[model samples]
Target chain A: MISPSQVEVDRDKGNFHYDTDYSFDAGIGLSEDVIRYISEVKEEDPWVLDFRLKALKTFEKKPMPTHWATEDLKNINFDVIRYYLAKGQKPSRTWDEVPDDVKNTFERLGIPEQERKFLAGVEAQFDSEAAYSRMNEELEKEGVIFVGSTEGLKEHPEIFRKWFGKVIPTSDNKFSALNSAVFSGGSFIYIPPGVKLAQPLQAYFRINAENFGQFERTLIIADEGSEVMYMEGCTAPKFETSTLHSAVVELVALKGAKIQYVTVQNWSNNVFNLVTKRALAEEEAEVRWIDCNIGSRLTMKYPGVILRGRKARGEVVSIALANDGQHQDTGAKMVHAADETSSNVVSKSISIGEGRSSYRGLVQMPGHLKGCKNNTECDALLINNNSQTDTYPAITVQGDANSVQHEASVSKVSAEQIFYMQQRGLGEAEAMSLCVNGFVNDLIREFPMEYSVELKRLIDLEMEGSVG
Target chain B: MNSLKIENLQASIEDKAILHGLSLEIPKGEVHAIMGPNGSGKSTLAKVLSGHPSYKVDGGSATLDEENILGLEPDEISRLGLFLAFQYPMEVPGVTIANFIRAARNARLPEGEKVKAVDFYKELYEHMDDLGMDRKFTARSLNDGFSGGEKKRCEILQMSMLSPKYCILDETDSGLDIDALRVVSEGVNRMRNPDRGILVITHYQRLLEYIVPDYVHVMSEGKIVRTGGKELALELEERGYDWIKQEAVA
Candidate 1:
């Protein structure tokens, strides 16, 4: 019989690390000077420096949100974390020109291979700055601007300035404030009106340094009647101490436009991943957030959407898996402000070993809105008796004509189920994997073909240690 | 020599003795029927032989073609060409019938080898049609919401797909209707070849009338008390099991 490791193992795929000598470092602390040093190193405008300085103050003024969050938040030491580190100020336009160490890291992660196969553009981020960024020439000629946020702010100020932090403002939460203060090396995309791209753009974020924080800022603006799909991936090597990854993503879908954003993050267990993502949809527009979170010590993210114009739609399809010593606290939020708006939220989670998963959601419709509808379904699967799952959904709907529905369920992979599959000649691990794949079968279909296969493989690796 | 041999098989569940030193054997090219009353340990024998986790075999040995299978895992037992049609099939939600059966078929193949999808579907459709099951049932979850007859037909479908050397039908005719029983019996009849040993456990004589076993064994309390031909089933059906119990006691 073939062991699980022989079938393209993933547990060791992201565990390797490389050493690099960074040319730029913003010291190890959070202060006004450090923020100024970052803004000056990037050679930003004076107004941008002011923005960073103000965000630093906000980050310090806000307290850690530990009331409802895990007590592990006290373990994060902001004083010792290196705020920013990069090899250079500018990203290499070609893969050949990138530094050998950074290039080799991305190569091992299969970034170049994926770019060659299906992606229209590829951005590889190392620590504090983008190392390699490229896009299709054909797309550039069609007025699609796909570049790093540094380049976007420097080149296309008129378009980037209008919606940089509009969707998720820095003052919205403590993590958002922290990300706004030290954000770097995230994708900035703008699809012009009436241009519908058939291919997706991808970005890969890698955290290479120890005792560091990687804060990325992403923004996508789909103009009127335009459509685009953007996907991002993240990974980090295991560290003895803790690391931090805080990102803020904002999406704006204009009238009659569509935008779909997908993210699959696999961080090491020593990393704390706290992110804020949201979208603003206009009349007849659609915005979808497809997110999958795996392998992290603590993750607290709730991707949301605001239906601002009449007849707008929003959706969030999420899958979160928490293994040993991990907690995945994820969900979605929807706010209906106009007439005839609709939204759907479907989330599934799996907790194995001593892992814990929680789904917290909110859906609100004011009294004046008419013909607005919302539907939410949350399901959780427990793999062991020690594993835990919880659901906390807060829904409020008013007005006689509006409608809302919510459903929640919790299931366990019973011994009988496992025995039944074993009786059919499947080994214990194979039976467990099949049962898991079956539980998330319908949701996995929503992912792209390539990612669905990888997701199944990753789950198989997670189940290897699950059988006791 | 090629047979399922049980020697003084003793078993229990939850510290309660159920099968007390019951011994039986079914050689190749023969069909055996075990008829008993409610508490006579008919189903326990099947569970014990299949190595169900709940039952503990205190003492004895069971062999499939001279290979000991008393303590092996259920999957290992199954891979050795022993198939037990469960009395109550499990409902595995969201696992489609096709994929479930394909997993079983794939497990039998050598490592790194897979069953060709086209051939698997062709054979599955043929067996499903023979059992009068709907063609669309392949996409449905494995016995998730199926009726009793449909569940029975699915069990038989799995049995036919695996094609084990030894088959044990544990009360396969309990919930089947008249028409379903006929179709199921026909399906079992088609699988009755000289290389296989079939054991049917039932509380009534109705199912045996269709399959027509070669040997009829009357079980009382846990042991087989009387061994006879197919005519013995008709005699018991005409009379009752009380005389058999009295005879065993006497």
Candidate 2:
């Protein structure tokens, strides 16, 4: 554990490569043989193999999405991506038990140190499996289960099987189907009734290999009256070839329970981040997605929620920054299935240089649901003349007497605003950062304190010398 | 000695001429006031001196203690001990007053050295108290939704925190109430020292009554038409700017 005196605000320290002795490799391409190889290495049952094969068939049948940003989506070549690579290691309760190379990689990312200081639990996923995962003694005593997905399915099948694919099925989207077919390391968290953890649990997903695909399937279930916050962070080294990160996350909050799922994705600009995340909120339950996207060549993610019971609430507070050579097409979806359910979506984006950021949202409310309210706000800021942003918010409100309001705005940073801060002793770049920070300050506050500070520093780095 | 000097300063916005061959010299330990009517280039002089990008300096030079500040960025000129309190302060949403001032102060420091947090807050609270600003103003976004008087008081608070060697208050008295004007004047009065110079530009004489200047100059056509002692402000208040324009003609 790193003491408080040794902590500094630093992350993503560039590429760190090593000569890894791979214990298992599925090589490139996806087929029945590759699926069989992954299942054989994991020693999974025949039923699990059947699930992977069925999902693989679905993934092959689903056509590429041509509705939005199809040109960027066409750049991804599934044939070239290596499906799985695991550095032989089971989950270690202690940090020292991990291998030297994996240990060095995580120490640079400050995983164990953060767990010691603030987090209730920490799970570090290297390539295909969890390298280290541990929870606090108090949380363990309170019947909180925090472990890898494979371990969860093997040990706690009764709880895991019930909510596995209930929130999001395999055929939800093309990427989700791809993830279900070859999914590997991801977090599986369970909290019993009335057990409210004081700190958040975080999983840091790191991709170290070239032309690799990281398909992490995360499932979290909050029991009745329980509350928890699960944070997911991503980073990868710079490679000449493209990398793929397609994750499927499903969350279930039982009656009177609350859950918050936050994602701070800082993948290298060479990677494609296509993810499907959704949650099911029961009676009086609340779920939120606080997402911040910074570095990615292309990202298409829209985390949604299905309000399953009366008085359930959902919210998506997100901020996306797209610098040069990046496109972030991300938003939220809210479905009002139960009466008196409420939801809100606030999305803010910044596009600088030749970058592009967009907001694509969907809100659906049926006619029978009364008193269902939803509010959606999307705001975008363009840094330079060449930058671009778009908003496609589709709202369907039926005969029900529900109130659904949507507001959006697209604006460029005015020269006057920049000059105002500049006159107060900030240089042009500093002024630009201040403006961008101001644009998304309210939503960024929704994040945890540590991540909020890091997000500001990341924006400052992106805005460095970005003027035309 | 610390000083700000401008010689034959000609500036313009777009194609129109604003400041035509303006000349002024303000030495250390003195407060100079310039009273002008609207469209007489009073605010333009402040913007040009602060290196506003929209204003083009056609000719002449502005120097802060022997260093030419015309071609430098606004921040560079500001760090060289030149401060311009804008006539209409822009509202920057989500940037708190505390952090903005801290960034400005940190920008003036040498590389790798940080301003001590304890000292910064202590000095900031003291300045806010003198300005009659609420303590909560520190956390609020700078000038966002501020009343006219609140905006001026905030600008004064910033000026006190920055402590530039040369201070320029352009039309600081335009939107102030009587009570706010007195509080703002007290805040400015507390910062007076032997090594720092102040230049106050206003269209009205009410502000001059509170913070009396060492010399009062009347600008008619971008240049100083007349100069005199403190009594000149009272004369201008009674006779109006027509006397000054006619004096230039005569």
Candidate DockQ values, in order, are 0.55, 0.49
- The parts of candidate 2 lying over 4 Å away from their true place are A1-14, B14-17, B112-119, B230-250
- Please write out the lDDT profile of model 2 over residues A1-468, one tens digit for every residue: 001111121234645655677789999998999999988887777877888999999999998887655587888898999999997668898999998888889988878788888999999998889999999998999899999988887788889988887788999988988998999989999999999988999999999899899999899999999999999888988889999999999999999999999888888889899999999999999999999998879999999999999999999999998877889999999999999999999999998877899899999999988999999999999888778899989999997489999999888877777777787788887877787888898988899998998888888877775763
> Tens digits of per-residue lDDT for model 2 on B1-250?
3579999999888978999899988998899999988889988999899888889999998899878999788889898888888788888878899988998898888887879999999999998888878899999998989999999999888899999999999999988889989998888888788989999999998999988999998897788888999899999889988978987999
For model 1 the local lDDT of residue B83 reads 91
Instruction: Pick out the ten consecutive residues of candidate 1 chain A with the lowest summed lDDT.
Output: A1-10
Q: In order, what lDDT does every prediction score? A: 0.90, 0.88
Best model per TM-score: 1
Q: For model 2 chain B, give the 10-residue run with minimal summed lDDT.
A: B1-10
**Fraction of true contacts kept, per model?**
0.57, 0.71
**Best candidate, DockQ:** 1
DockQ-based CAPRI category assigned to the predicted complex of candidate 1:
medium
Flag regions of model 1 displaced more than 4 Å.
A1-10
